[model samples]
Target: MMRLELNLLIEGLHDFEKAKRLGSLSNEYCRESATIYLSQEDSSILGVSDGDIVEVSSKHGSVKVRARVRSDVRRGLAFMPPSPYSMALLGLDEHPSIIKVTVSKSSGEPTSLTTLFTS
Candidate 1:
């Protein structure tokens, strides 16, 4: 059931050709890299440091990524480098977004890297 819902969500996002066109592609269909920013308050709360691993989760799903803590400060805010991995967990739309991520102290399993690529 969850897989079905996820597929539908992905399909809906893929319907927006213009948005997809705006996305940068490295292999014609995949995004290579993106810039992500974080707020100071969130960084403090999560205790995220440069090269720290952050596990972001939402009602729909969850993802883990390497975090690069920034100097800028804003409470309850964070960002993720745009890629298929982030997109899968974050969904495609900007407004009425699907997911809210959380930064944490726990180190996620190393095997999790495969999921990032598979997305």
Candidate 2:
């Protein structure tokens, strides 16, 4: 796969229903929050499709997130919901809202958010 080097731009998006219906405890909820939105141009470059989980890594940290192929995002950039996964990536960078990340398809289910830092 031609993995893509992407700089993720955090938009601080919040989903009330995701929080209200499933609450924060559910892995599904965290997965939803951790989903990454990548532009079609970039997704094709990475050879990934929507819902395909990808590992996003930066200088500070890394996290796995489901890929959302979209044209709405700028090429060379992506968007992620504000969550522990995304925050972990942010912790590595001086800029709190954005981070440089490499995008690649994950072999299996993305790593769990709860155990991301621990195991």
Candidate 3:
């Protein structure tokens, strides 16, 4: 599948309040996390729509999660709230903030955060 290089931004969202209060293991916390924000143009190019499952792969690893279409993010850019899903691709290391990843529509369901942290 075709891939693109995007300026990745892992930032806090409004749900930070709820996640902080509920704790990371809480369902509410997991529900409010790991959403990948992509521009409408980029989403279409990948043959995906909002809420579609997509696999984002870096040289390190890959994570399958839900895609979110947003005007807030410009083309060639993506935003994902910090969570276990992104952590799988990030691992535990001092890596560059900007990553070249392949984002493509996934044939399977969006991976759960539990599985992400596990195997």
Top candidate when judged by lDDT against the true structure:
2
Please give, for residues 3-84, the per-residue lDDT of candidate 3 as tens digits. Answer: 6667666767676556857898787777567568899889888888888888888777888877889887799999777677
lDDT of 2: 0.78
Which of candidates 1 and 3 reaches a greater TM-score? Answer: 3
Instruction: Residues 1-119, candidate 1: write the lDDT tens digits.
Output: 01111111122233233345655443333321222244555555666666655555555456655555566534555554345555656544543333455445447532243466674
Over the stretch 1-119, how does candidate 2's per-residue lDDT look in tens digits? 66788788876555524562777767567767768899999888778889898999987787787888877788998988767778778664268777778988886777686676574
Q: Which stretches of candidate 2 lie over 4 Å from their true place?
A: 14-22, 117-119
> Which consecutive 10 residues in model 2 have the weakest lDDT in total?
11-20
Better of 1 and 2 by lDDT: 2
| CA RMSD of each candidate after superposition | 9.3, 2.3, 2.2
Pairs with backbone N, CA or C atoms under 3 Å apart (clashes), candidate 2: none
What TM-score should be assigned to candidate 2?
0.84
Judging by TM-score against the true structure, name the best candidate: 2
List ranges where model 3 is wrong by over 4 Å. 91-96
Give the alpha-carbon lDDT of every model.
0.45, 0.78, 0.75
